[model samples]
Target: MVEPVDPLQRLPFGARGPLLDHLSRLRHDLGKYVSLQVRWLGASPPPEALRQAMMADLLETHRGPGGGIDAPTVWAGLRPALVGEVPLDDTITVDLSGDVDFERLDDAMARISGVVRDLRGGVDGPQTVATGIEAARTVSDACRALWSRLRGG
Candidate 1:
């Protein structure tokens, strides 16, 4: 049962840059819309605009001094010697002590997951056929620019 070892895997995580940022490589399915012929329906249509927010951008924008994606994920695989029977707000308390905002923390995490899900599968935004075609080109150009600390025009 011998197998070859991946040289990339042997390197520390930091040594691997965007090589492991699979997030970017995920599938992006672009949805499309078009006008219908002889559609004189008088009902007000639902708002065509979609609220597209980049969750990671908000996380990294450091108007404050220190910034990082602090979540329970970092405390994962924690093996405490004991599990308490105590309950905090109906949640089973663990032997390990941490933040009291467990409820809100979970919600925050779900939001990040949702944004990632949408980005991977959902279309970026609404566009006509011609615009959608143009979007494919513009998107490729934008993605190539890596975010940096420098602020400029």
Candidate 2:
């Protein structure tokens, strides 16, 4: 078994609490983001194929075989590290095992953040859409610790 790295060791010190706290919150809020995303996809009644594709991607990306380091996985990792209890069965199962690359997840998260920011910036969108995007951003922000710790930034 690959030994888990001590996330705190990566930090410079003094920032551990805030960083860990952020990751913990991110893990908590990720659920809200998923719920909002699902609701937004359904609200417009978009084409069945498109919706299915999106959800399929989400499932594969977040819970499928290879830990893609999406919000959920990142969130899951933090709890066990912090509480000293490894999660044997996630709320959603992951089929592959390995260290997650934070960079890719970081980029994907940035894109999502941008979209959410636009909604909040008054980009002339429907209230529902704006609300959903805002919710997603709010949830994503909760993971700042997860990102920082993972990225060793």
Candidate 3:
């Protein structure tokens, strides 16, 4: 028997705007965190309070309503990247180590930026929806790549 398809896999092409918007917002938030982390590289260890605050802010952003995007979906998209090849807890965490690979982080940010740029190109209707779905997938893949590099996988 053919396996049943997931409904989410069939999200209508016209309904992609919210998902795209969520990703765009996520990209913006992550960009800020990455930038801050990069700036602190090779400097004294980042303050524990600052790290905690940043994590809280990032979590808030992820949990906030993204027009229609939900937290579980976002986590699902990011899980592969977050966990890498090794199985690990699904909690969202980041490396605050000064030895982080900034280059890879920048690359991931660039990919996200590209998606946002593409989606904002004035396309409308079904075309925009299609673009949004593609953009989301691209960002997810970028995250996976970034995580792999970060973990030295």
- lDDT: which candidate is best? 2
TM for every model, in the order presented, reads 0.23, 0.30, 0.27
Residue 25 accuracy (lDDT) in model 2: 53
Whole-model Cα lDDT per candidate? 0.26, 0.43, 0.37
lDDT order of candidates, best first?
A: 2, 3, 1
Each prediction's Cα RMSD? 19.6, 13.6, 19.2
Better of 1 and 2 by TM-score: 2
Misplaced by over 4 Å in model 3 are 1-61, 65-124
Candidate 2: list runs displaced more than 4 Å. 1-8, 34-101, 113-153
Instruction: Please name the candidate that would achieve the greatest TM-score relative to the true structure.
Output: 2
Ranked by TM-score from best down, the candidates are 2, 3, 1
- Write the residue-wise lDDT of candidate 3 on 1-153 in tens digits: 977543223433442343344334445544333223323443554555434332332233253455433222443453333223322233322221222333343343344344344434643344433333333344444444433433342
Per-model clash counts, in order, read 0, 1, 0
Candidate 2 at 49: error in angstroms? 12
- lDDT (0-100) at residue 70 of candidate 1? 18
